[model samples]
Target: MPPPGQDPRWETMGLVHDYLAAEFPLINKTLSLAKVNTYGLIYEWTGTNSSLKPYILAAHQDVVPVNPETVSTWTHPPYSGFFDGESIWGRGASDDKASLTAIMLTLETLIQKDWTPERTIVLAFGFDEEASGIYGAKYLGKALEETYGRDAFAFIVDEGGGFKDVYETIFATPGVAEKGHADIKLEVTSPGGHSSVPPVHTTIGYLASLITEFEKNPYPVELARDTVPYDNLVCMAAHSRDIPRSLKRAIFRSGHSNAALHRFEKDFVLQDKFYSSLVGTTQAVDIISGGVKSNALPESAFAIINHRINTLSFVNETAARDTQTITSLAESLGLTLKAFGEDVIPESFYATSHCSSQSSSTSSSKGHIELSLAFNHELEPAPRTPTSGKESKPWDFLSGTIKATYYSHRAQGIKTETTATDGDNVDFDPRNVDGNTDTKYYWNLTRHIFRYNHKNAAYGSEIATGVHTVNENIPLDHYLEIIRFFTTLNNECR
Candidate 1:
């Protein structure tokens, strides 16, 4: 995979393309492979039955840039692609190169076996996903729409939630949905004055109070069993033997004893780092600026609040609610404020109006407060992929392949260890991915978008698939398991 923010060279992709063009001449002649937007690669293995909508296996061919200062800290060089007799160490080893390799190898194997599908299969690889898909999946999605039309895919699969052991049981978590993202900007302006003669609170001081309010009153938490994350906990409780019986019973009877279920989830499930993100919209005051000089009270203050909207709420709604909360808080603090974005006045007009309205209070109205949400990029919560009913065939096939990948080894008198005890068969759990993937750009192509990558570890061992960090690597055995899963899924997805 090429490093992030660069052109979609897809050096690995080009190599695979050339190899297939030479080795599998028949496949080269039959399947349609094209580079979309000069960066995204799309390979379509046309099916005998054109009536069936195609299935897309999507993965990216880009990795985040490694910090130069951290180079000496790595066991192997970041881009060395070293095999240390146990795992492959490199920057993109686990994140996405593994998935790309698995897809190409699976296709090559299928072509060698002379295998043909009844339904079409598409392999879509985006090259600039790490830099936010502007040049890759976004254009690929548009090209696909022009070629295959909207809703032309049976399902789209991408790298996201993976199989992991939790509570002594393997949970095959295919990310059925993902959280939305937004960046809100807050600003305040006041009459400039000498620091010695300033009011009780300056513009920066009011901004600080607003930030405190946001932290004190975060988005409300919901633990209803119907929610995706809570439901997943319920599924885990039902399958894992390590969970307390009382907690399992509370989860099972969540609908009947709502308070008990909420308490149990808040005390137990939310304690985990992964599950804490799912319950509510998370707010972080990531950036702040104020005060230009030590001798003068600054006239302006600015802050940027980043939010990850939970699957339970819509992005627009979450933003609106937060705007209201901030506006109310500012008003309570005796600050004359005007909110921005959705039902709030335009920033230019609001600032101008405030500039004209002279001295409403003894302290010149305790400074004019401005709340605006200038979203750098915003995305709504992804559509939830179905896990039940006839339309869930793709999910069922993917889960079955994961199960088969681990279970086949056990059947051969091989000991397979998950986070669970040896010989414990892992079960599948449908849940939303906490992080976003390239699949976000392809939502228009299909409702059945699944974000999954295989990564369950043996009990007491580290899950070494560290993304965007130093010492990134993937266990060789786990890499093989990924390939096996993809091979099985490729053959069975129809």
Candidate 2:
């Protein structure tokens, strides 16, 4: 993967493409393939019936680059593709390559069995997802929209949350929505001078104060009804075995009572930082830089605060909150404030106020502070995927498929059925992705978007398995189960 704004190096990706072509000859000959931006792969298997809408299985071909300093800490080489009779160890083993490989193998198997479908199946593989899919899915999305028009597909499945044991029950979590994203860049400028003659506060000092103010006030957490997190909690309360009785009752009542909802949020959600972050817009000052010399005062200082906006909020709202956060401090420091190119505190107003004050006699204003979007990428929260009622047939079908996959993989001699009805083997729930994925670009192609991979989260320690970190690996049985899930989905789709 490349850095945030840099172009990806495609030498290794080209090799992977060649390897796929050589490995899946039947799929290559049967399906139509197109390369978008010379790297993004799109494969389409046209169905016999043109009346039914096609569905897409999306995956990324790239993985986060491994750190060279951590190479020695790995049990196996990051790129080895070594299978120690249990798991496959490599960089992209679990994050994405697993899904891509599963889709291909599923298609190849179906082709070998001479199975023809009434509904078409499309596979979209982007190469730069680790860097926000700028050069990959962005073009693939356009090509897909041009070919099929908007809302052409029945649904889209991308790599995301999978099945995990929660409260002693196996729950399959398919991401029904994703949070919004923004990076706010805060910059402060002041007069440079000798350290001995420095003013009461320097540029760095003012920036620190602004950052402190931001931390002092955070977005409030609310358990709004109909949200993904709320729905997930309801499912947990309804299906999980070991939830506290009182908490379960509160979760049930939360659907109608605002008092009960806030109580649940206070007692449960707010108690955990992880849960609170998912419910509210989160902020983190990831990057900061200031002085170049110690002998002289710093002329300018800046910091980039990353935000994952809640599903209920928008980019403008977040920016407004940030502007309000530091306005008072900026005014007290006699600094002009310009937020997102709009002047909040004008130089003349501060100068006039300073002159009018009895204690302050200076007519000239102090330096200014500017707030702007760090990157041009500002995404609104994704449209929620319907998970119930008549319009949610696609979601029901997916949930049934997940249950069937889970049962058949574990129990022998059990026939796998893919009906959109309740079953006894496993439970399903809608969840939200805290971060964005390649699905961000394909939103217009399908209203029913599911971010899920059918891997069991209980296979190993999540941090130990190391997605985007050291010792990344996937169990061989888990890989086979993913292929099984895809095969069943393709077979069951009408």
Give candidate 2's total backbone clashes. Answer: 0
Tell me how many clashing residue pairs each candidate has.
0, 0
Cα-based TM-score, every candidate:
0.85, 0.94
Q: What's every prediction's RMSD, in angstroms?
A: 4.5, 3.4
Candidate of highest TM-score = 2
lDDT of each: 0.76, 0.88
Clashes of 1: 0
lDDT of 2 at 438: 92
Candidate 1 per-residue C-alpha lDDT over 14-127 given as tens digits, one digit per residue, 9 for 90 to 100? 664565468657556667889876657888898889889998989887788899999999989999989988889999998888888887777777888889888898888887
Residue 416, model 1: lDDT of 42
Tens-digit per-residue lDDT, 194-309, candidate 2: 89898999999999999999999988898788888888899999998778899899999888889988888999999989889889999999999999999899999999999999
